[model samples]
Each structure stands twice: as structure tokens, then as C-alpha cells.
Target chain A: MKKETLILVTNDDGITAPGIRNLIEAVRPLGKVVVVAPDSPQSGKGHAITLGSPLRLNQVDIFEGIEAWTCSGTPVDCVKLARDKILGRRPDICVSGINHGANHSINIIYSGTMSAAMEAAIEGIPSVGFSFLNYAYDADFTVPRQVAQEVTKKMLETALPPHSLFNVNIPDVPLENYKGIRVARQANAKWKEEFDERRDPHGKKYYWLTGEFSNQDFGNDTDVWALENGYTSLVPVQFDLTDYRLKEKLEKEWQFQ
Target chain B: MKKETLILVTNDDGITAPGIRNLIEAVRPLGKVVVVAPDSPQSGKGHAITLGSPLRLNQVDIFEGIEAWTCSGTPVDCVKLARDKILGRRPDICVSGINHGANHSINIIYSGTMSAAMEAAIEGIPSVGFSFLNYAYDADFTVPRQVAQEVTKKMLETALPPHSLFNVNIPDVPLENYKGIRVARQANAKWKEEFDERRDPHGKKYYWLTGEFSNQDFGNDTDVWALENGYTSLVPVQFDLTDYRLKEKLEKEWQFQ
Candidate 1:
């Protein structure tokens, strides 16, 4: 008999979120699942790790019979702990998110959901982060559940490109109406940020971050285009941040002392 | 007379830390500096932004004549707040850190210092993050101070490539022994993580995350190689995480349904 596939599942929406629960149900049949996730929401936490504080992890019965632990750390910490403490070895593959919202385009820069998967990718594990375009707590996971099942199944059987991870985003559409998945590029887009200034009860001023998503690229091959066209967009993500084109430009044209 | 070059300065080691103080002094002569930074150390905060909580900023006089503000947020949040609130306009360039530790290679992925600079780059500002290979609270800033002045002068004179940010890692060496700066690539590296499990006074177990820096690549044109050779490593960093090379490989090799 073949060895059972070991799967690690985590999310940024805390352990109790409907999103991760949906994800667990969708992928449990694929392999033995172990979940280590943040005990509280870590939505805007990028690739943060806890250095100044000690972390606590407790085994919980939150997912019924699933082996799960709620961790007091960032999404990345959850993955680290899962590898070091829970698994005692690398999991066959790591899957993060089924995030509460879309992590498309430049939003990936600030996404804890994507960061967790990226951490696993850095560890040379084939990993994928799944997100629904919907942010609602009650957003029907009917579409993402099917996408997760399909993607997780495919990932189990196939090998991803070396050092490359997947950012799988399902468009918020009825499952039957969804078009097929498209491998796409991240669109050149950004949040046009605005600060909402408000006063506390003590009259101290504080600011809340708000933004509008602005896609400046019209590339038909981009994730924005795929999502807008009713397809599940899959973008290959990596952790190398070097701009090779600009490196050449800097070397020849700019002088540094 | 030249218009005063507006410079935004921040760090992951917090406003009162000696490292940020060194950074402020180094760039003092370059421009009209506006210092906005976190109130406490946020060492492992990557590109995180505060979304679940409100942010508070207060004008501070800690740097004598330098205009500064202590922010109740992460390093990335300081940059955003600097742009929209404190500066009330985009600064000519943003410089983050004479960080308390190394941010070369994989450390950059978990670095709050690099993230602050990355955030500024995302907002289209020419930016750089500087770090010492030293992580001590009282580490000598003699080398970094001179390097900072030189890099700041050079950046003000030359426009960096569009959307380009620099990650500069200084060797923890004497200024006179310093070799020339090398424009390099981020080396392949990762922390070999170990979790020290210990029991609390109340008998609950907790973990302290610890890691040993492990450099895997033998490439000479890497940041790690540069630092080991007594040269400051300058890697032109970008926020785009798409693995184009792998994207191509995946297209030709992997079949998706």
C-alpha cells in the first residue's frame, strides 16, 4: 500500500473561521491533515514572525477528528511550528488560506494567507494558497470548496515548478457558472490608499486604513483579467525579489561609491 | 539654492533604539529629514500593515532638532503614515534602517526594515533599506554611518530604476578596512529553525523560536558572498514576486484542468 500523503493546512483567518473549516472538509479526503493556525485573525500580517514574544500552541478538537493546534503566532509562525513541532519533519505539501478575501495582484504583498504558503515554498515544499474573492464571513464556500478539491487533488498527483508556489484564487461566482481555471500573471495593480481619521472616546485621533483596488494593467494574461472573466486564476508565486532587469540597468548606468 | 531634499526615515528597531538614532544622524546632512517610526521594536514584521486596529501617531522631539513622530504600528505602517499624514506629501526618497541585525537573503523576507523600504517603493518612491551584520544593541555604527551618508548622496543625485528598492547589507567591520560596494543578488539562504520547548511557571508548555543562518549557495555574485568579503552588498529589490522562469516551465510542463 502506498504511504498516505501528509498535508498541512493553515489560514490567516484564525482557526475557527468558516473558510479554513471549509478548506479542511474539502481536502481531508486527499490525505492525512494536520492544521496549525493562528488563534486570532492575522489578515494584514505579511511574512511576520514572532521574535519578541514566546509562542504557545495547544492541540484542539476544533475540527472534530482532525489533528489541529491553535497557535499564538503569525501565519508564518504556524507553518514553522507545524514543521518543527507538529510534523517533526516536512509535510508532503503545505496549503494555506482559503483566505477570507482575495489576495490578487499587489494585495499579495500584504497578505498573511499568501505568506504562510510562501514560507512553505521557501522550505522547498510544494505549497498552494487558496483565496475566495469574497470577504464575507458567510460567503458561500460552495465554489471554493470545489476548486479546493480539484486543485488539491491535482497538486497531490503533480509536481510544481521548482521553488514555485501557487496563488489560487477563485472568483466569487456560482460553482456551475464558473469557467475553468487559468494560469495567469499577477496584474500590475495597487490599492489607492486613503486614511480615515476618527477620534476615540477619549478624543485622541486615530487612523484606519482603507483603499480602493486599482488595476492599471489591461493584460489579458493577468490574474485580474482571469478573475474578471469568471475564471479561477492561478499565478505561480516565488520569494525571490530580485529585479534582474534593473540589476543590469544599475550596474551599467549608475555609479556607486 | 537647491530645494531641501525631503527624506523619510524609519526602522524596525523602534524610534528610541540606538540603530535608528545612528540612521538619523547619518542622513542628517543629506536633506530635511522626517522621522516616523514605530514606538517599539518590530523586528520580524515583514510587509505587515495594521488593519484590525487603529493607529496613533504623535509628534516627538526625541531627536533634538530633527522633526520626528513615534507611531503605534509596524515599520510598513510608519511609511504609509509618513506619506499620508506626517509628510502630507511624498518625500523625495525613503530610507529605512541601520537595522539592528542582518537582512541579507532570506532575512529580507522576514525583515520589518526591508518591508518599510519595500512599502515606499510600492508607492513609487525611491527607497533603500540598510542593515548591519551585527545584531547587538550596542553594535558599532561607525561603518554604517559613513556608508549611509555616501548612499544617500548617491541616491539623491541618481534616480533609481522605476519601482526599484535597494537592500544594502553592511559588513560589521571597521570603516577603513571596508572594501568597495558590490551590486549583488540575494543569496540562497534560510534559517535552520529550532523550537525550544519549555514549561511555563504554570506548567503550560511554550516555545521560543530560534534559528541558525544557513547559506546554501556558493555563488560569488550574491549578497552573502559580498558581506563575507568585507563589501557592502547592494541588491536592487522589487516587490514583484512572480516567478517568470517557473511560470514558463509550468506552462510547458504541467497540465491543468
Candidate 2:
């Protein structure tokens, strides 16, 4: 008999969040599922790992009959601890998030959800991060759940390039209005950040980070375009951050002594 | 008269670290410098931002005459807060670190140093992240200081492509042994992680993250190779994580519905 496929599930949203629960339900049937995720929400944690402190990992009976562990660290830390301690061996595939909000465009860099998946990719595991457009606690996961199932199934069946992962974002639409998934590039866009400055009771100033994502890229093949057109965007992502074009340009034209 | 260049300085190392002080000194003569950095060390913070709570920014007099602020958040948060609240306008350039240790190869993704610079790049500012191979608190900054000066001068003189940043790693060598800078690519490498599990005073188990840098790629043009060969490696980096080749391959071969 063939060995059972091992699937590691995690998210930036706390393990108890409805999003990860939906993600777990979506991929549980595909393999022997194991979950190691943050005990609290770690949404904007990006690719952070806990370096200065020890991490706590305890098994929880949150997902019935599923081996689930809660970690007192960021999402990326959950992946690292899961691989080094809990799983003991690399899983067949790692899936992170049916995240509460969209992680499309430049949000991937600031997203703990995508960063967890990216960390798995760095470890040479085939991985994917799924995010829903809606940010509400009671946001409908019907569409995201189905999308996760499809993407997770395809990811398991397909042979992806090494050190690569997928960023999948589902549109907030009913099943009837759902457009098929589109293979797209990351759009050139950014958050127009504005710090909401307010004084505390002690009259000391504190600031809350707020931003509106402004997309200026008019490219039709970009993730923003796909998501705006009501399609679930699937952008193949990698960990190599080098800009080869600029490297080549500098090599030819610039004088470095 | 030409307008003074407003340079924003920051680091993963706290505002008081010798690394950030050397960085501030390196660029001080080149522009009107403003320093905004973490109040505590945030070494492996990557691209994390403070979201669940508000951030605190307080003015500091550690760097005499040079304006600086200490933020109660990660390195990336320093850049965001600086741009939106502290500076009230985008700085002409952003420079992060002369970090205490190497941020070459795969370290960039886990580096608070590089991520702070990356945050500036994402905001459309030209930026550079500098790291030395030394991990000592009192590591000699003479060489890295000179390197920062040369690179900053070149960066200010040239017209670089927008939305890109540089990751510069200096070899741990004295000035006499230093080879010139080489524009290199990020080496494909990863940390071979081992979790050191121990029982706490309360008899509860906790784990410390430990790892060894493992480099398998033997490419001569990689940053790892440059550092090993006694040269400072300068890699032009970008935030777009999309793997276009894989995206094209999946779009053509895989069936997604």
C-alpha cells in the first residue's frame, strides 16, 4: 500500500479562527492532516520568526481527531517548529491560511499568511497560501473553502518547481458568480499608509497603522486585475528576491571599485 | 542652491546599537539624516509590521545633533512610521543597518535589517540594507562604515530603477584585506534548523530556535561566494515575489477550473 500523504495546515489567523477551520475542512480529506498554528492572530507579521525567546507548543483538541498544536509565536514560527519538532519529517505539502483578508498584490510582504507558506517554500516543500477577500469574523467561507480544495488538490497532484509556492486569493462572491482561477503575476501596487495619531489618557501620542491599497498597474495579467474581475488569483511565488535585470544593468554600466 | 538630500536611517538593531550608529555616521555627510529605529533589537523580524496594537515613537538624544526617534515596534514599522508621521514626507533615500551579522543568501527574508530597507522600497524610496559578517556587539565598524559611504555616494549619484533596494553584505575582513565590492545575486541557501528542547523551571518544555547556514549552490556570482572571496556583495533586490517562469508553466500545463 502507498504511504498516506501528510498535509501540514497552518495560518496567520489564530488556529481557532474560522478561516483556518475552513482551510482544515477543505484539505483534511486529501491526506493525514496535522496542524501547528499561532494561538493568537498574527496577521501583519510578514516573514517574522521568534529569535530572542523560546517558543511554546502544546497539543490541542481543537480539530476533532486531527493532530493540532497551538504555538505562542508568529505564523512563520509555527511552520519552523512544526517541521523541526512536531512533524519530525517534511510533510508532503504545507498549506497556510484561508486568511481573513486579501493577501494579493504587495500585501504578501506584510502578510503573515503568505509568509508562512513562503517559509515552507524556502524549506523546499510545495506550499500554498489561501486568502479570502472578506475581512469580517463571520465572513462566508463557502467560496474560499471550495477554492482551497481545488488548489490544494491540484498542488498535490502537480509537480511544482522547487522553492516555489502559490498565493491564492478568492474573490468575495457567491458560487454562481465565481470566475475560474487565473494564473497571474504580482501587480505593482502599494499601500498608501496613513498613521492615525491619537493621544492616550496620559496624553502620550500613539499611532495606528491604516492604509488604502492603491493599484496603478494596468497590466491585464496581474493578480489585482484578476481579483477585480471576480476571479480567484493564483500567482506562483518564489523566495529569491534578486532583481536580475538591475544586476545585469549595473554589471554593464556602473563602475564599482 | 540644491535642496539638501533628506536621508532616513533605521535598523533591526535598536537605535543605540553600534551598527546603526555607524550607518548614521556613514551617511551623515551625504545628506540631512533623520534616524527612526526600533527601541529594542529585532534581528529576525523580516517584514513584520505592528497591526494588533498601536505603536509608540519617542525622540531620542543618543545621536548628538542628528535627529532620531525610537519606535516601540519592529524595524519595518520604523520605516512606515517615519514616512507617514515622523518625516511627514518621503525621504530622498532610506538606509538600514550596518547590521551586526550577515544577511546574505536566504537571510534577507528573515532579516529585520533587509526588511526595513524593503519596506522603504515598497514605498517607492531608494534604499540599501548593509550587513557585516561580524556578529559581535563591539565588532569593528571601520570597514562597513567606509563601504556604506562609498555605496551611499554611488546610490545618490546614480538614477536607480524605482521600487528596488540593495542588500549589501561585507566580508569580515580588515581594510587591508578587503576586496572591492561586487554586484552579486542572492545565493540559494537556507538554515538547517534544530530545535533545542528543554524543560523550564516549571517543568514545562520550551524550544529555542537554532540553525546553521547551509550553502549548497556553488555559483561564483552568488553573494555567498562574494563574501567568501573577501568582497562585499551588493545584490539589487525587489519585493515582487511572483515566480514568472513557474506561473507561465502552470498556466500552460495545468488545468484549473
Candidate 3:
């Protein structure tokens, strides 16, 4: 019997999105595919789990030739559910997104796409989150498939670092004109959050979230630079949030009684 | 004239929670306090931000001395909003939470309390997140006052490490019996996520999120250990997710074209 690879699939864009459909199509030939994704889009859910309320999981038939389930929880919930209840066994690999928007720079801190991948990595499973530079309802995902396919193939053959995962973002370019891949650092970019204040029909004041992406780091070795240059950006990410350099200094300065 | 200190205040337990009110009381005398927080409870929202829709802000007269506003967003959003819209200048200090529960070990990843502080730290603001090791709707916060005051004063007097913030969890003991503070590391502990399946009144199956906290770490210097020993735990955390030790190995193994 061939070593059947169990590829756990999920996304923040919900199960019915074209991105996951494309992902499922590409990875179906590789091995056994199991998709546990949110029933609705969970774009900025971050590392959130479903603790506030009860979660519901229903068997979904959104994608053919793949075992699928829709979760009434965040992206992290999908991964947790797949690992504990659905798979019950350790999966060979986990892949999240082909997200509609970029999970680059500071955006990673708020991305449901990267959080799903981070959840898998925290569980000691090799995982990757693929995203696009474009943020639209129907952004082009043509170039993403080829890059995503190649990256997935490489990971299936070789293992990633423990407690580490990839935040891969592809430029919104055509497949034919796309440059290759680039291993880069997360760019020091952030959103200058500006809310668009407006009034509802009932004259109730409301605000819409808006922001301008500001890239401060002009280094060529960053994911933002790679995306701007039309290359596939792969930034190695980890879950250890400790500021190790500050640790020793703090220990020495602060008196612990 | 006293130098007008810009203080940014936020919380995970919603803007109306008693926790933020207690926090506001502690910090109001020290600076020009600006309270921007979620309209509803966002306890487990993590580092989430609103990406799909616009965020709303409502000016509410809650706290008497502090300038408070409720945001239609996550805890991280409150920080961002305060940074951009509310504060006239860059905040001298940012404080999140007098949280109802502990943000010990890996729980910080899914904690909106810590995330609000982490967001400010990323923006180069001196930040601290204060939590008590108790989970109750009407938990007593008296024990945390001295610890919170000390940490806040220290951060104010001597600026904290850039890209670093405090994750402070006070012991749940009485004020007199509480052991002193401890400079600690995030314990290598995690929630063993378990889902409790039950049938809804509408005849559909639902699952309640349940987890048992597992701490296999035996190190005395860990946060969990400190908290268990009746000490307040302060762990300095950062946003750079790079595992630099593995960088050289990954660079050699995986070549990016």
C-alpha cells in the first residue's frame, strides 16, 4: 500500500470559496484530503478559539472527491476539530488558505488564515498558510495554484522546523509572467487604521474600518518587497512570542521576592 | 504644569466591564487616560481586528475622569483606534486589562487582554497587560492593585524594552498573603482542547468548547509555576515571530529562487 498522506485542509474564507476549491483540486492527487473549514468567512479571527459559545459541525459537500465539514467557529476551531474529532490521528501535513487578502507583515497578527496554520504548527504538525496580495471578493487565484502546489509538494517530501510554519503570499500576477519563490522576512509594515464615519438609515452613527498599508522597512529581504517584485514570498513564522533579548535584562533588573 | 502623560487604556472584557473601570481608576491619576475598548465582551478574541467590515466607535459617558469610547471591534482594535483617532499624541504608556482570568502560558495566544497590550508594544508604546488568576463574573480584584501599581510605575519610570511588553498575572490569594512578584518565562503548557457534543433544542447536534489546562513543565522559572506558588508572574513578550536559531538551517536546506 502506498503511504497515503493525510492532508488536512482549511481556510478563513469559508468552505465554498474558490480559493479552497482550487486548493482541493491541486492537492487531491497527492493523498487523502480532509477539509474542516468555517461555515462563514472568519477573516481577522486571529488565534481565537470557540470558548464563548457552543460550536456546530456539519458534514458539507462543497467540494467533490474530498471529505469536508463546515464549522460554526473560527479558523483555529476548524483545525482543532479536524485534529481531535475528525482526523483523530495525526495528519501528515496541514495547509490553510490561499486567503483572499495578504497575511503579510503586521497583518499576520490579525489573520484567521495564518492563525489556522499557527494552530497546526503549535500542535507540532508541519503547516503553511498561502495568501494573495489582492483583497477582493473575486481576486485572481490563477498564479497561486502553481506556487502553492510546488510549495506543498516540497513540504510533503521534507519536514519544516518544529514550532515553525510558513506565511506564503503570492503577488496578483498571471502564472505565465510570475517570477519564482523568495524566502524572506516579515516586512515591518502596518495599517494606519482610519475609520470612515457614516450614518445609517436610522441616523445612527457608524464607522467602517479602513486603513492604508504603510511599509517602513525598505529592505529587499522582506516579504513585502518580494510581493512588490512579483515573486512568491515565504516568511518563516513561529508562535514563541517571548522577547528573549529582553528576558535576561529584565531578570537582572527586576527584583523577584 | 505636570507633563501631560498620554495613557492608552483598553480591555478584553468589554468597555463596560468593572475590570477596565478598576484599571482606569488606578491609571487615571498618573496620566491623560483614554479608554477605548470593545462594545461587547471580546475575552478570547486574541489579536483579531476587523478586516471584512468597517469598525464603529461610539462616545460613551462611562468613567467619570477618563475619556472613554466603545468600539465596534476587538481589543486590538481599541488599541489601534486609541493610537490613531483618540490620542492627540503617541501614548506614553498603554495598559490592557485587569482581566477576569489568567493569561498564563499558552493562553496568551488566544487572549484579547494580552493582545491589546501586544498591539501597543508592536507600535513602540510601553505596555502592560494585568490579569488575576481567577475566572469569575464578579471576581475580586483587590489583590492585583499593588502588583499592577508596581508594574505600571516601573514601566512608567524606566521605559521598557522596545518591541517588548509585560504579561502580568497576579496570584489569586488575598493581598496580605500574596507572595511577591516573579520575573518568569511563558510555561510550555497548553489547553488540551476537548469538545463536548450535545443536541440543541432544534434537534441539531452542537459542541461546547471545553479544555483541561495541562502544565507538564517542571521548571521553577516558568509563569505557571510562579502563579501556582502564590507569586505574580511577569513575562516580557515581543512580536517578532522569527525563530532565528533555525534561520541558518532553513536557508541552507530550502533555496528560494
Candidate 3 lDDT score at position A106: 84
- How well does each candidate superpose onto the true structure, as a TM-score? 0.97, 0.99, 0.94
Model 1 agreement with the true structure over B1-257: per-residue lDDT tens digits: 96778999999999988888998899989889999999989999998999999999999998979999999999999988888888977888999999988999999999999999999988889999999989888888988988888887888888566566999999988777889788999998998789999999999999999988899999999999999999999999977777787778767876666
Tens digits of per-residue lDDT, candidate 2, A1-257, equal 98899999999989889999999999999999999999999989998999899999999997888999999999999999999999978898999999998999999998999999988999999999999999899998998999899999998888777777999999998888888899999999999888999999999999999988899899999999999899999999988889999999999988877
lDDT of 2 by residue, B1-257 (tens): 97889999999989989999999889999989999999999999998999889999999898888999999999998999999888977888999998999999999999999999999998889999999999999899998999999998899999888876999999999889899899999999999889899999999999999998899899999999999999999999988888989988988898876
The true-versus-predicted C-alpha distance at residue A45 of model 1, in Å, is: 0.6
Model 2 - which docking category?
Answer: high
Which model is ahead, 1 or 2, in terms of DockQ?
2
**Model-by-model lDDT, in order?**
0.89, 0.93, 0.84
Candidate 2 vs candidate 3, TM-score winner: 2
Sorting all predicted structures by DockQ, with the top scorer first, yields 2, 1, 3
Compose the digit string of candidate 1's lDDT tens values, residues A1-257: 97789999999999999999999999999999999999999999999999988999999997888999999999999999998889977788888889988998998989999999999989888899999999898999998988888888887787665555889999998877789788888988887788899999999999998878889999899899999999988889878787788888878886666
What does candidate 3's lDDT look like per residue over B4-117, in tens digits?
888888999998777888888777777788889899999888888887776778889878856789998889888887777778688989999999888988889999999999
In Å, residue B17's CA in model 2 sits off its true spot by 0.2
Model 3 chain A lowest lDDT segment of ten:
A155-164
Ordered list by TM-score, greatest first: 2, 1, 3
